[model samples]
Target: MLKLTDMTLHYGHSQILNGISMEARQGEVTCVMGTNGVGKTSLMKAISGTHPRSGGKLELNGEQLGVLPAHRMAWKGVAYVPQGREIFPLLTVRENLETGFSCLPVSEHFVPDEVFDLFPVLKQMQNRRGGDLSGGQQQQLAIARALITKPNLLLLDEPTEGIQPNIIQQIGEVIRHLRTTSRMAIVLVEQYFDFAYDLADRLVVLRRGEVMIKGTRDNLTRDQVLQAVSV
Candidate 1:
């Protein structure tokens, strides 16, 4: 459902992504894996419009989305759960979820019951401030907040980073459910090899701002991919 052709990006004259081309299909997890400084998060920023591409094309559902900003992208069904979780420290859990209402119509302002079902802990701490939650809870809140936007294209950058093992497993299940149940086109940028490999239907390995390996999981083994990303 998402197509990127020759996608390029730069920061202050230094090119981060060069001639990158990839596609993410509905009901599949397209995991982007790489070593540090390989432009994984930079690619996510470009797709989510947090940073504009230097040159290239971004198309969603056959419609070319030419250099739109984050808010515009969100309206077009792109939800980004960035690397740091970025939840509001002072806001209550419910309030943070409600923050997504800015992208929705006024009639759809209420929080959906399924959100609480996905993270039952969030239901119990509806009034607790975001900063009070544990790291894992915060991560779940971040994903739930993104889901509140009802995105067709979900860009998740390193959801497993710094998360506890059990929570990481929960997050994996959530991602699996999202792809299978809703057919969302998920583009995940992950450094955790096992986590990415298990969930990825297709994998794209990037090195120095370019694709080094791109193929289905059945065609690539963990050792092969691990060797490529190992610096």
Candidate 2:
């Protein structure tokens, strides 16, 4: 559902992504893996329009897109759960979820029960301030808020980072359910090897801003990916 062709990005001449090309399909998880400083988050920013790409083409569904800003991208059905959760510390859980309404029509302003179903804890803590929640709870809140956008392409940058193991397993189950039930394309940037590999339908490994290996899980072995991303 999403395609990037020879995409490149930079921060005032210090290039981050170099001619990176990949595709993410509906009902599948495309996991982007790499070690630190390998431009994994930069790639997420470029696709989500948090940072504009310097060159290359971005296509959503089947339409070609230009260098649009984040809100515009959200309006086009791109929901980003950026690293660090980035929730409003002072806002209540419900309010933070409601913030997603900025991209939707007034007629569709109400939060759906399915969101609460996906993260049951969110329903219980709807009235609590975001800053009052635990790390795992906050991460659940972040993912839930992104789901509020009803995106066609979901970009999750390191959802497991800093999360406890049980919550990480919960998050994985949520991702699995999404892939099975919806046609949304999920592009996950993860450093947690086993979690990422187990969930990935396809893998794209990056090293120093370029794609080192890209293929289906069946075609690539665990050790092959491990070796590629390690170096």
Candidate 3:
């Protein structure tokens, strides 16, 4: 449901992404894997409108997008779960989720039961301050907050980083369940090879800010993908 053609981005005078092309389809996890300094997070920023693209085209559900800003993109159904899990430290869990209401209509202000269903812990700790939660709980809260926007395109950047193993498994289960039930296009920017590989329906490997290899899981084995990313 998301397509980026020849997508390019720059930082000051330096180019971080060059002629990159990728797509994410509904009910599928499109994992973008690469080593550090390969522009993975920059690509997410471009897609989520946190940073504007330098050139190329971005299309969502067949509609071409111009240089839109973050709020506009969020309103257009792009929910970004950033790498750092940027939850509000002082806000209560419920309040943190309510923050998503900014881009949504007034009638849709309430958090859905499915959100708490997907994250039962969020329901139990709705009144707790965001900073008081553990890292994993905060990560779950970040994803739940994004879901509060009712997005069609979910951009998740490194959800597994620094998370405990059990919580990582829970996050993976949530991602899989979302792909199965919501049918939203998910772009997972991840470096954890096993996690990405197990969950990815398609894989795109980036090197030096460009696509090095990309194909469906059926055509690419774990070893092949591992080799591509390890370089």
**How much does each candidate deviate from the true structure in C-alpha RMSD?**
0.9, 0.6, 0.6
Ranking by lDDT: 2, 3, 1
Clash totals, every prediction: 0, 0, 0
Q: Which ranges of candidate 3 are over 4 A from the true structure?
A: none
- Residues 53-100 of candidate 2: C-alpha lDDT, one tens digit per residue: 999999999999999999999999999999999999899999999999
Tens digits of per-residue lDDT, candidate 3, 1-231, equal 999999999999999999999999999999999999999999999999999999999999899999999999998999999999999989999999999999788999999999999999999999999999999999999999999999999999999999999999999999999999996999999989999999999999999999999999999999999999999
Instruction: Supply the global lDDT for candidate 1.
Output: 0.94
Model 2 lDDT, full chain set: 0.97
Give the winner by lDDT: 1 or 3.
Answer: 3
- Give all candidates' CA lDDT scores: 0.94, 0.97, 0.96
Please identify which of the two predictions, 1 or 3, would achieve the higher TM-score against the true structure.
Answer: 3
Q: Could you tell me the lDDT of residue 197 within candidate 1?
A: 90
How many residue-pair clashes does candidate 3 contain? 0
Q: Among all windows of ten consecutive residues in candidate 3, which has the lowest summed lDDT?
A: 100-109
Model 2 segments more than 4 A misplaced: none
